[model samples]
Target: MKPQLLFSLLLASSLPAADAPVQIGSRRELFADSFLIESFSGTHLQLQTPRDEGVAFKFDQPWEGLFSGYATLVTLGDGRLRAYYRGKAVANKDGSEEELTCVAESADGRTWTKPELGIYEVIGTRKNNVVLMKAHTATHNFSPFRDQRPGVPEGERFKAFGGTMEGGGLTAWKSPDGLRWEKLAPEPVITKAMVPYKYMFDSQNVPFWSAAEGKYVAYYRVFEGGIRRIVRSESSDFRTWSAPVLMEYRHPSMQAPIEHLYTNQTHPYFRAPHLYVSIAARFMPGRRVLTDEQAAAIKVNPNYFKDTSDAIFMTTRPVEGTAHSGVYDRTFLEGFIRGGIGAQNWVSRTNYPALNVVPTGPHEMSVFVNQDYAQPTAHMRRYSLRTDGFASLHCSYAGGHAITKPVVFAGRELSLNFSTSAAGGVKVGFEDVDGKPVPGFGLEDCVMQIGNELDRKVAWKSGTDVSKLAGKPLRLRISMKDADVFSFQFMP
Candidate 1:
């Protein structure tokens, strides 16, 4: 043997062993990050932005206007949508009596109307649609979600976290249904005394029951070294929480940049529970674009135009056994959603996204962003994308391929959510851990996959049933030409 060959063998023997096969049962894996992939030859994973679909719901009601923002949408148990948002017309101090939490009802998300809840008399009569008011600072940025934790009491089926740093810390609330709510505790649950951060809870602090972590997770705002960042805490029950720790940032290939993340809208994707997607607002302080004359022309508040903001997308996956790594993956450095084509679109605290991205159709998902901020026309607009379409493994017309790390999955068929041009297609092949192709599952046996589908099974010459490979280690090699693959799963 050549001396170079002998030296290469010695180097390989000193290296660490490869990672164990990932155990993904039936979970739908998305290309939002590079976790599942090992190598790429000609293809690269490209992050996708949601399509702007105009206004989904307008906050033009008498109780909601100008300053109305921090919207959170929840799909109730009965399939109807219950949207909650802060109702304030005047710019006032935190927890002002004028600040109210209002709800809008929608059978289908296309049309929304305020239901007469008759719960409180905030601005005069009790005939208004206010769900919470006159409760101190709790209603200032009250964010509630339907608790889906198994064995959770019916009375506490709904839970919320809302309070300013001055109001105490993070207060808790519970509701049997979604409308009527009462304080879970008279005092704030996570107080400033419990954490080192002095400035926090001023923005919308989100707390929810995470089925993925099997615990309650809270993603709240904090200012460290003059820059706004996020900290995380977890709880077995909704009452007691672990110590808050700052989350770490990671990238597949590049260094993650630090920016002012105003509100970290971190929540599990409805379809993929294990993956948490954060549609955070990137606050660019002092990054003014609108001149005083242009701001006045659009009727935007003079003070608000001094700075501008837009929404960004991120993802976080729980580290196994460790519970929380607090590491968020910054797959794409570019902005997920950009400022619109107008002067009014540039303003402080504008373009902040709501909490959850819910399904509007069988193959479609919608995310809402607060737009036209600090102006009379301020309203929540909707953006839609194909289900599990946050990012995709894309290939140009020249064609390319990507190989996944060794994985052991459970199911009978490999279902793919992909799109391709009429002349372009994708092919799949299975390889053993040693890099040899499996006889019947090689790329040569695959039928070309074309067209768009939310879930199309990968078919080989032997058909789509992959149950025989269940629980065994195998790698997937996907080759595509002018195609995009959003997500994939092993379905029963």
Candidate 2:
């Protein structure tokens, strides 16, 4: 053997054995540390900004004026997308009497239509899309989600929770079809008495059946030490929930500064059900962006211009067998969706995102935002990102590198969703679990991966065949220059 080839084989043989390969099935595993990662240089993890897709539909209806917000969008199993939001024409405290839960449907995420459900009579006309009406405080923030749990009752195919302290804590509602809703219980299902905090259920309290944890989970607003913070609770059945535990951020060394997260739209990423993504409204209290003159010119609600807010992205991985194991990563603390051009976009509680991100087209997914809040133009605007393109392992023109702790994956070929400038590129090399370079797949053997592609294959002189590494523990040492790797997976 050549001297270099002999040394390479010796190094590979001397490395310690790797831990068992993790069975990361073809789910859209994000680089959000859903798996362990280690050893990096010069690279920065970046959050991809969503491109504004313009007004999805204006909240121009008489019932849905300036105060319309707290939007929730869900994709039905039948391929239809449904949008539900609270509609109010005037500004008032949470759970105001004028608030009503409204619905809209879309064949494609673009081009929405509000069908007259005729389920509830409002303003002497039953021709509106109001699904739940006059339900005490429940309609003030009635956020609904399509129940996808196995063996869920046929009559309770859909579920929702909404109510305030005055109206009682959170109440449960069920519906067979998205249109008709009935209270699952007369009293509050999750009451204030059940939580450690004094106040609860005031904001957009969200709940969804967590398939990852095999139970129901909710992330609700609570005042902890006089700051607006979030707490999580779980339930075996929808009626009874566990006591709330304050959720803490476990960010990287570059921790995100403490701030008020008003509305936490925490839900599992549709493509990657195991990863919970929170598109929250980060409120900067007293951070005024508009002068009285500018606010008056835009005709915003009087009380809404004093503070500013924007949308942020966070994630948590609910570990099984551990109670309250949802650890939130706040590493990327920047705004995922910034307030747009005008004073209208930065008003208090504006730029709040809708619930789940749904597939809009073949290569894209969309997330809706409540924009222009408290202004005449207040409406849900649509924004989009490439599928599984939330955070990326990125490096600048100066170049950088990163490595995985140890991954045991099944599959023949490794696929990557990445992008790079014409002058920038990336290369991959495999290391034994003990950090020794594997033969034939060393950095020098890797072909320079150039261009931007969603599913590009990584090749080396030995070809792209990585079946030999299947079902075995290994590590990946990636080197890149001016490039971003959004996600990667071992494929058959």
Best by lDDT: 1
Tens digit per residue, CA lDDT, model 2, 141-197: 888998988999988999999899888789999999877899999999888877667
Evaluate all candidate structures by whole-model CA lDDT and list the values in order: 0.87, 0.84
TM-score of 1: 0.95
Q: List the pairs of residues colliding in candidate 1.
A: none
lDDT of 2 at 177: 87
State the lDDT of candidate 1 residue by residue for 1-492, as single tens digits. 532234345445643346778888899999998888999988998988889989877777777888988889899998888889998888889888888899888876778888877788756777777998888798888999999999999999999998888888888999999888999988889999876776888888898888877889999888878889888888887788877778767788878998999989999999898999999999999999988899999998777898989888889987664535477899887888898888878888899998898888888888989988889989988889889999999999999899999999999999999999998999989999877999999999998999999889999999999899999989999999999999999999
Model 2 residue 153 lDDT score: 96
Clashing pairs in 2: 21-408, 22-408
